[model samples]
Target: MEKQGVEVVVAHHERATLRAGNMFLKIDTDQARAEIEIDAMERAPIPTPEILWRRPPVLALAALSGTALGRLGEPSTASSAAWAAVGAAVRRLHDAPLPPRPGSGIDELATELDTECEWLAANGVLSTDVITRNRRIAEAALRPWTPVFTHGDLQVAHVFIDGDEITGVLDWSEAAQGDALYDLATLTLGHPEHLGDVLTGYGTAADLDVIRAWWSLRSLRGARWLVEHGFEPNSPGCEIDILRTQALRA
Candidate 1:
């Protein structure tokens, strides 16, 4: 085998992904999470990266053959049909048999949301009015809902598409039984322009207000963690922009 140069895909304290030729090596400090990710990939109905092998803390997977649907802080070049295809794939995943592991409950999410909001305020990350209004909007997501098999973290970047078809999805560590709407909300976060296209393929009516509320909730909760992880949640078209946009709409 010819030696290929390794490229750093993503790096943080918890985990790092390295790419060499057509193989991806995911190294995680937490082996339990890696085990869960492997199980989730095996159980998921939709396309996922092919697991080449696994060795304790490092998991090797064959790279998929498509570009990511989009980045968080950049405009998506994928067509509406591509986005719609991703939505359809997500619907299939949601309709699959529930995973054995349960996701975060509403109570847990509420507590985290409150904690994050307080931190954001105390750190002077955003204006009080923005945080307050966004927090109010975020409350709509705390209601009860039927749980389904969910991706849990279906960010657009995790979805891969070639033309108008979905190739595969990545990052399965968060997969579990949870609210289906949370998956939809996560997919379209920071990319509101594709909501209608996704809903068209979802083949069901969804509460837009609740989805918006999740946008607020997720942004509020993720901002601090992102900062701690050396990521910029305040970048253009990211979490902070999403929160500020909610304020402008009010």
Candidate 2:
């Protein structure tokens, strides 16, 4: 599709559809998402498409409809291994020195968490206790850890692979500079019972435990988001139960 001298591909993978041209445009309504991507690009993150346009409500609606399909369960070993490779790559990315937070202190993550909690509550999907617990866990984890470039939504889909090698880690809309472990946690939480291969590929047994706890905390946040975004409560389509179970073990 051609529009205003731009060729729109409408490339729909698992997340936002891409509209391509001189730059790239993402149409996800999640403001935190847009900020994450733009910020990562500004900070010289790993390779990712550039965003030049946005249709937030449209994207949000599409995501919600897809989540209702009950197709969120299941795991793929190939994909899991690929995700582990992506995690290793992200670790290398974070190894590089980074600039200070652009306009806010690193502590501003608390503000972002508050905003996410408020939005989830407004949507009638998350409990205050869940949000509060997540906040406390996050603050504690980040306390001693130094901030680094992080993929705010690292998961299987965001990671592209060819056989055992990772081709690219896509989707930067959720990337930020914080505890790098937070990114890994996002991935493991999304696939808790299914992360055996990934953990093995990424670290030792001790590191695995650390990774799980980090992911558990981040997964709680993702659970609230999934519910707020219209995934049915206690339904098989939702992974909050999976996350909660993992957190309990952690």
Which candidate's lDDT is highest? Answer: 1
Model 2 misplaced regions, further than 4 Å: 1-25, 28-47, 50-72, 79-81, 99-142, 193-210, 232-238, 247-250
Highest TM-score scorer? 1
Off by over 4 Å in 1: 1-3
lDDT of 1 by residue, 53-151 (tens): 999789999998989999999999999999988888988998889888898988999999989999999999999999999999999999999989998
Tens-place lDDT per residue, model 2, 1-250, is 6564544434333344543333444555566765665566556545444333445533221111011100235444565555566556766667756644432244665566567667766775546565455555555544446677666667655555666576555566655556665666666554655456555654633245546555545554555555545555355424555544543443
Error of 2 at 125 (Å): 6.3
Candidates' lDDT values, in order? Answer: 0.92, 0.52
Q: Score candidate 2 by lDDT.
A: 0.52
Candidate 2 collision pairs:
24-52, 29-56, 185-215
Q: What TM-score fits each model?
A: 0.97, 0.59
Candidate 1: residue 240 lDDT (0-100): 94
